[model samples]
Target: MSTVLRSIRAAYCTQAVVDWLALEIETARPTQFQWLQRTLADHFGDGKRTYIDSIDADASGATTRFLVRLNDDHCRTVDTVRAALAALDQRHTLVGPALVKLLEVSLDFYPKDDQARAYLPLLVARLQTSLEAAGGTSHRLVGPTKRAEHLDSTDTPDPRRTLYINNKLDPLAWRVYYKITDRDQTLPRDQHRARVEFTLQGVGLHQYGINTVDDLAALDFGDFGHLLHFRQFKPLPDLIANMKPELAQLVQHATRRDRNMISLYPFGLHAYRRYNTGKHAGKPRNGGHPELRKHSTHTTADAELNQLVRNRLHDLTQFFTQNWNEK
Candidate 1:
C-alpha cells in the first residue's frame, strides 16, 4: 500500500486590516483578505465559496477569520499547500512566509498493488476489530501526543459499511478511520479502493508538534508510527487454516460463538492455556500454542502491511522537505 498526503490547511496571520465588505463589492482591499480568499478559492477550492469563521472589528483594528480548505477535490500532495502559501506571499508582497500556521493535515492509505485489491476493503473491518480487541482505546506511543487517547467514539452502523473513529469536528482532535468508496459506486466497485485516512487538526497538530509549515516539513514518522497500531491484525480464518492441527483445535474451541472470529492469536492463546491446565489436564500439557512459530500470518500479513504504511509516512516527510515553487 502507498499513502497520499490527501489534505492540508495552513493559515497566514497578518496585522494588515482591510475592508472586507468594500472588497466584496469590488472596492477596496485588492491585495488583502478578499484577494487571498478569491485566489485560494479558485485555485484549491474548486471555485466554491470559502467560509469565514469570524470577523472582529474593534478599536484595535478589524480582522477576518476563515478557512481556505484543501481536501480530496485538489491534488493530493504537500506541495499543493506549499504552492498556495507561496503564491499568497508573493501576491501580497508579504515579508515573511504566508499560510505558515498548520491547522490540519490528512494522509490517506490505499492499495498500491493490483494484487491487494481484494484486501483493501477489508481494512475497515480489520481496524475496527483491532480497536475493539485492544480495549476500545488507542494512544500515541511517542511524540507530544504520546499517551493521548485517539479512539473516543466510533460510528459503526448496522450492516457495517464504514468505521469512523473519534469522528467529530470539535476540540481539534485526531480522527482516523476507513472510507469504503464514493457514494456513486457500490461495493466490489472499480479498483475496490479503500482508504484509511488520518486527520489531525489544531490541538492534534500541536500534539504532534506541527504548529507551522516548517514544523510539518521537519516531521519524523518514527515519532508517530504507533498511531497505525491497527495493522497488527490479520484475517482469522487464514490464521487458523495455517496453524497445526493441535493448535488449531485449541483456537476453534476458544471462541465461544464463532471459531472464525477475526482475532485468534492472543485471544486464542489465553483460552488454549486455560484448557490445557484445567479440563484437559489429563493430556500431556502442550507448550505455547505454536502460533508465534508455525503461523506466519503475524510476520507476513501484519508486519508487511505495517511496514508499507510506515514507508508511506516517510515518503510524505521527504515530500514536505522538498522545495515547492509551483502549484
Candidate 2:
C-alpha cells in the first residue's frame, strides 16, 4: 500500500458553532491584573482599538484595580489553532489556567447573540515574554441555561479573538496566546510607549510528575532543547506507550502536534506551488502514488502560528454545541 503523509490537521483542529458562553477570570494578584491588560492590548493591537480604561493601586504600590478596553471585531475566527506553551521558555514565569482564562475573557467577543449572556472566566510577548506572575487565577462559566450582565454589543455579534475548548479532552493541552504592553494609550500615537519590564516568572512546572520546586529543580529543562516541538514530539511516543489514562488527553494533543509538524506544511506551500509551478509535488516527488489527490474542500489556508491572533471578540449567544454545561 502506498503511504500518503498527510497533515493530520483536521484530527487536532475543532470546528463547531457554539453560541453561548459567560466567562469570568478572577485574580487576586496585583501584577497579574496589569499583565492581563498589557497582554490584551498587545495581542489585539493591529486592527482593534484597545484602551487602558482605568487603574487603581493601593498606597503600598499594589496594582489592585485594572480595566482595559479590547475593542470587538465581528469578522474573526480562531480556526485550527495550535496552543503554544505561553511560558516563552522562562522557568520562573507563571502559566497554566489563570493566564489562559484571562485571555479567553479579553479575546472572546460574541457579537451574534446580543440577547444572550454568560459570566465566565479566561500570552506571551512577541517571542519570549511572560505574563506577570500571578496567584489564584481562575474562571467561572455561567449561563448555558442562565444569564448575567446581558452584555450585548449588537444583534449580529462579531467574531472573537480566541477560542480554546473547555472539555475533558483538551484541558490545559490547548494554551495558545500572544504577547506585550501598550500602556499610555492617552498620549499621541508618536508619543505612545511604555517600559516593558522583563521579569523572571515565579511559576514552576507542574506537568508530568514534576510539580514542586525541588522536582522542577531536579529535572534540567536545560536539556529540553529550545525547539517547542522537541518536547511535544519526543515525549509523545512514551506517553502513548505507557497507556496511562491520566495522560490520555495529553497524548491526544501530542499526537496531533506530531502530525501537524509534517502535514500542515503542505497546506501552506503545496497549493501555492501547485498553481504557480504546475507541479503537484512542490519540489520533489516521493515513492508513493504518482499523482497527488485534490482535496474536496480547501478548509485551511491559514498558516499563522497557533499563537498569532487576528480578531479577538466576545458575544452573548451560546452558539456552541459542546461546553461544560452542554455536555
Q: Model 1 scores what on Cα lDDT?
A: 0.40
* lDDT (10s digit) by residue, model 1, range 55-166: 3434443343333454333324455556765665555443433232223333443454544444443443444434222222232211222333332223222113433444
lDDT of each: 0.40, 0.24
lDDT of 2 by residue, 1-327 (tens): 001111212111212221111112223455534455445435444544434322455655455333332222311222101011122113113323222111112221121221111111111111111111112112112232343212121111111211111222321212212212124245333321111111111222233243322232233322211111100122334435656677766757764767433221112112111322344434344422233332213232223322211111112112211111332
My TM-score estimates for the predictions, one after another, are 0.52, 0.18
Prediction 2 TM-score vs. true = 0.18
Task: Give the distance in Å from residue 327's predicted Cα in candidate 1 to where it truly belongs.
Answer: 13
Superposed model 2: Cα runs more than 4 Å off: 1-23, 26-29, 32-35, 47-57, 60-71, 74-327
